[model samples]
Target: MISAKRIRIEKNQEVSANYVKKKMDFINYLDNDSLAQIFMLLPISERITMKEVCSKWQEACQLAWHDIKKYKCTNTIVRNHKKCILTQRYVEKVLFNCGIYLKELILSLICDSSIMPIIAEHCKNLKTLEFALVEFGNKNTYRFVEAFTQLEQLKVVKIHISGYNFQFRMLNSLPKDINEIHLFFKPNGSPEISFDSGIIKSTLFTTMLFNSDPVAPSFFSLKKFTNLRSLTIHRCIITDIIQEISRKTTLVYLDLEKCKTKKEIFTFNQLLNLEHLNIKDVSFMDIPNLLSGIFNACKNLKHLDAPDFHVDLAEIKMENWVNWRNLVHLNIRWQASDAIIENIIKHCNNLEFINIDELNSESTIELTKLENLNHLDFEVTNIDNEVMVAIINNCKKLKHLVLPEYNMVKASIFYDLSKLQYIESLNLAFSFKLGDSAIIAIAKNCKLLKCLNIKNCNITSSGYIALTGLKNLEELNIEMSVNVEDNFVVKLRGIKSLYCSGCHELTDTGIIQFIKNNPDLEFLNISFNTNVTMDTIIAAEEAVKNRTNDTFLAIKSVDSDIEKACHEASKNRTNDTFLSIKTNDPDLEKACSESQWLIDC
Candidate 1:
């Protein structure tokens, strides 16, 4: 009995509604592969939240989980596992819910013995395992090793034993196919275990022993690893391992940092394939001969960290480094002359990084010829303006320049630095000569600067305003810089970490306003600002709570009389507060200890 015209209008309206709903379903239009790709771009927390949106989103999250391969538990979170059951439960939940298989697992905590069996059962495809600060009972050690042996695909294993009454013989239960083994023994503890030459003779590729007793019996001989490529021994005597190392012809990387060894221990002619050699803190009275022998044989060496001893350049020639064309990184604490720099520039054309103690005018001139140099650490007694200009103008690709403890007297140095367009990080700590003009030049020119450290400089409030031009700056450290007042805090923008400790000119109004503007700032250090009271602390807490994000604010002052007053002010706070207040007052620290908001005071 309805009218035909009315029925026709209703049909049209229904069709329009369906069309609009179809247009709104944008995510449903994407294919499964595209949705999975989008899900992979999200952070872990967002990804977890996405699974509740729809069935399609859940499927995409599953696909994303399949791509994950590594899991790590930090040391601090694991330290609380002994007393906090919630921490242990959270770790277990993350492990079980993420994925079924992981390739690498690194735990820097004391793991429970029962958890290893569960990990072995679920993560059967694991290949690399590392544990630091491990504690195990006498019976649990064997069970832990036995559970690890079930993983047929394991390739690398590293363990640092800190518990007492645990024997090293438990290592014999490890699978024979492991290619790398790193073991560290604590002080005053010795393990009663002997290595059978046949156990590790076939497939070992790398070995490291750290902090072992010097007088302990040799566990094994490295000569058995016919395919060894890297070996590292630290804080132990090398007298017993020298012969075994001499026979490793396939060694490519060797590190003997802080090892007790003499000059005659290194006759490294047999290691023809050696490319990276680190001998830091090793006393070598005959350094010239040792270096000559290494340069003659290891022509393919690419990275070398030589001894801290002095080398007489008069005894060596330019031709000695002629075959070192492949060297790219070098760290030497020795004094060198202009001739040494000239030879290095002429031969090592591919040099990209260098750390040295001294450089003269002529030597700096030679350093300008390195077109591929990206990092330079130069410490000198005096540097003139001309040398600084020449180096900055020539090294166009320089990214990191560190001049700690250098005597820089000229303000023209800032003008020279502004020419470096690609520089990202600059450290001029203890250079008391730099003032407002230098900071302004840096802010105007260095567009890509991300980290700036001008600690203990003569920069004032007027100079600090120039930093507002840096849009990409993420870290700024102006500790001990004088004359910083309220106006200086208003100009900061887009900074994730700000360090302004010892700036006594700062007050409560400036800091509270700064915190409100930068609500997402993660770290703020305003220690020694005596004007900052409990009102500033309350303002910071409010700002962070409104955003629902975690932020750390440090406000330690020399005045201790307000400890009781601050403690009384913070007692009413709840556990839901998102701000962590760090202070030096003992009474306030004890009061904040019960609240979850206090991280470390």
Candidate 2:
């Protein structure tokens, strides 16, 4: 009784349905290992639903997460459309599946009350825990300890208290047998809870401020704990503690911050085994004497963070020069004369890491002399071309280097880094004169680079294209790069994070090419581009959706979606501009900005 046209349309519909069924059923052919790998990459939202699709997939999801040893629940979302790990549903899923196998747990929560109870009931094998939580006085402190008391294997706990007023009562209820504890809080009220200062555990604690008093003798004690190897105390009286620990030869690491002493001077000679001493923001009246004592005594000091070293040439006693040979890390945060710096370099010849942020004179420290340097940080510093050339030529063994924020070096001098074959991370974010040749040289020689940050250097598409050869690069920051365009992006591959904000030459089709080409791309910032438009956002979202949809054709579907995006763009994109229709659409602008916030925030 049906017409001939209706019969033809029905036949075509039947064939189309059969094709879709075949495509949907393709997942059943994948082996367990392959399915598990696919499940591992699926975002939290779809992965949960995908597991319920079939019994085989359920097993694959289980296998995918069974080996996880660390569980992190945070508000940081690294990818678009994926819910943050702090979401209760996601946290519950992780805890329910792999909580028993977890050895470490990290929680960065907004409100303290919501998830603490849920987390405490799981992760029995957790050996360490770190969290940031709000304070609620005594009742919350009791709840906090009760929640964690079940973790029998937990040995280390680091806590960051968040609240407007913290009485620091949480310390009393913390696990007593915990061998190592580090607590960070802004002490707001009176100091109430106390610890067994005599023979207590090794602890790194920031204590309550004692009403502007320079010393708080009765607040805390450090009479014993001979087994303690590391100690960090902040804003408390440290004179007596030092007197007590001076004889504790087992102590090797000490960090004192803003701690004052009732006495005018002290000595560290007794702590001969000290290897790492970090003193910051403390009274400097006795630091010179303390440092001189330390230099004279501690023969194995590998790490020293003392900015209070305002010592001059005369105080640079050659008798202590032998101790400098063992120094591996030196951070000059404040004053240092050219002669003192030269002596530091001359004596600490085996130094592996040096950060001098306060350098003013280009002649202060000769870069060429530091042949053994592995990491150099000159951030916020000023240096001339001669120093730049010396670094390029001499410090070739550097694994990490941060050039001055701004430099006047010529492109020719910047382009000849053929000797730095071992460089791993380089930040040329504001070196304005650097151009394509420099990037080409870096790509040719620095093949081991993993992080390259060139936020606003004078780089063009050719320079960016040269970067495509850096297969090991994981993060690239090209914010405000004016010359970047689609030809460079479409050819690039395998980067996790890319910041290309203010790149005006990129368009929707080019960005679509990038999104579909790079499967591992987690973050992309094409904000403020002059040519990108609404199609780019829709394409990015579509590509990500295809990836998380649990279909075998997800990647193949991306290309088809891009074709659709082109068609859609031609039909609707009349007002967008620069990485946008034209940068005038309010809705498109909001979308571009929000895309950047997932990672930047």
- The 0-to-1 C-alpha lDDT of every candidate, in the order given, reads 0.66, 0.64
- Top lDDT model: 1
Each prediction's Cα RMSD? 7.4, 10.1
Error of 1 at 395 (Å): 2.2
- The global Cα lDDT (0 to 1) of model 1 is 0.66
- Count: clashes, candidate 1: 0
CA shift of 254, model 1, Å: 3.8
Backbone clash count, each prediction separately? 0, 16
Write the residue-wise lDDT of candidate 2 on 101-201 in tens digits. 88888876534645556667777778788887655655665566676667667666777654444434344444545545565543435222122232111
Candidate number of the best TM-score: 1
Which tens-of-lDDT digit does each residue in 1-601 have in candidate 1? 9999999999999999999999898778898778878988865445666777898887777776666688776322212112111244545655665636689887655466666776777777888877754455556766677766787676677766554334444555555555555655343333222123211111111233322334322444554445557666543345546656766777887776655443435577788788988878754434355565666777889988874744554555455677669988877655566667777788889998866556676676667789988787654545667667776879998888877564665777765788888888888888878778878888899999988888888887667888888988888888886777789787787777788888878888998888887755777887776776667766776676565333444444334433433565567754354556566666557655654455455
Point out where model 1 deviates above 4 Å: 1-64, 72-86, 97-99, 108-114, 134-140, 155-247, 259-267, 282-292, 312-320, 335-339, 404-408, 460-462, 494-496, 512-523, 534-601
